[model samples]
Target: MLEIKNKLYNSKERKMQKLFNKYMGIKKFFRLKSEKIFPLNENEKILYTDKYDYKEKNEKNKSDKYLSFNKRIHILSVIPKNKIENFYYSFCNFVKKNPSKNEFSKIILDERLKKSILNYSNSLNLGGWSNLGYTTPKSKELENIVDYFHLFIFNLSEDYIGLDFTAILNKDFNHKLNEFMISEIKNEPNYCKYYVGNKRFISKTGLNKDIIRREKLDDILLEIKMRCYDFLNLYFDLFPLNNKAPITFDEYITNYEFNSKNDYLLRCYDFYIFEDKQISRDMDIIINHNDKEFSQTFLDLYLC
Candidate 1:
């Protein structure tokens, strides 16, 4: 009887271990699939380094390998003027506490805060959104808070593209916020006007909102043009314009423009070098970006 009981216990432990391993295997499969779908930009690749277990690897090599996971921390929310203070303090306190061990028990002190914070461990790997209220297996202390803060912000705002928190996390909060606000003015002029009109909120944040709005729009515009030029340089290098003379970024942008959806499709195919097999495999990415309805549906899967 004793021998039989020991065998049963051992068998059950083995089964549990097998299940855990299987779960991890499935998770890894989907993660790889997602990466293949949405390739990370160069700047983003630098900040995305949490996928691997550094403990098993050499200590010296850990930092190098640990630097490659999420590109930007994005938040897409319209945080109300009344709740800004409460949200900011709650977030600051949460960060200060660094409660990775206790999980969601102390995530938000205010039960009145209705938005459920979501965690996207990998920005590109949009398999599913995990609730911040639960502890993720093997997640590092405070890693989720810093890396996945964007999802929380997404729940807050209804208008405009999400805010990029990458600059803020990298200790360039003020500069990034100014640039973002400036960008917002260009992208949604009316929205920016309304947001900055709130004098009380502007005072509370100590943002250089007035200076940028009044004096720096042209500077921001020039900076944006430079960024686009640089981005095109990278883009052209990755997806060369076949049969066309290698042109300067300025020349290319000035002379060549996508006149229609078909023109864009042709350019996309050129990027893949017109390899039938490769194009067929990666066509979904091209379609998702170019096709407005499908793009919305695809985004809704993750953001909605």
Candidate 2:
């Protein structure tokens, strides 16, 4: 965890040397094994994460349930060892404004947030107005990842084939992924925006007005996304995919109700990120960010 928070992308040698500094002394060996999930920083492109203050206490990542490594970071393969220390700092800082949640429940920068932070004028039009993702994944992977750009991840070891994740590192994402996945795993249909839930297109199932629990809903979305990609051969009708239609991230979470044909939707993908205000009335959804990492809380019902 400390390695991730302060990992240097100077080079693989520097990364390994730094990692070795805390090499578990027998006592921590097994516990440390889990941390060795991905490839060694061959070229160490570690995104600098220290600049921005995290929600946890004194920069203690463990204090933040979402930041916990064992829970999040599901599909990390070998993200290039980047020399972009400022990248991490820049990412974390941007997350301070437009934050996101990892599978472990930690707050991190949205993958697409990088563009906005880099301030490439008119960049919002870049990357399809989605969040952030640096290491785009191979088509075969996205099976278990939450979002390729951020760290939210998942693992269905019991009832699945291979690991799945959002790949933000794949150099050629759209084209290559299309080739590999063909009909198996592909982007949202031409007219769909994913709303998190069963076929009803609502955020909850078999319940009425019980949408306060955003975190649990997030977990449910993971299950749905996995099934949507692996099990369903692109369930287009069930999601909101049209380019003209703006996908509602948590339609049910709002005071406004939804109808199946309204074309309004809810989804976990368009996470609500805020700046200045930290504590939000997440209601039942998980809340992240600190005073500086966060400030006040406000809910703005989005209509694209």
lDDT of 1 at 145: 24
What TM-score number comes out for model 1? 0.19
The runs of at least 3 residues in candidate 1 whose Cα sits more than 4 Å from the true structure, single-residue gaps closed, are: 1-70, 98-259, 263-304
Clashing residue pair totals per candidate (backbone < 3 A): 12, 52
- TM-score for each of the candidates: 0.19, 0.17
Q: Write the per-residue lDDT of candidate 1 for residues 161-264, one digit (tens) a residue.
A: 12122211222432353344324322111101115455521101112333333224323322322332232233122113232222111100012222445443
Model 2, span 1-304: residue lDDT tens: 0011111123476555435434422323444355458532321212111122222211211222221011222222111122123434643553453333333534545555444434432222223222243332223334333234343212223221111233222234322322331123211101111355654221111111112233333443333333323321221112232322121122122222222222222232223443333433322122334656543332322222
lDDT of each: 0.29, 0.29
lDDT, candidate 2, residue 21? Answer: 35
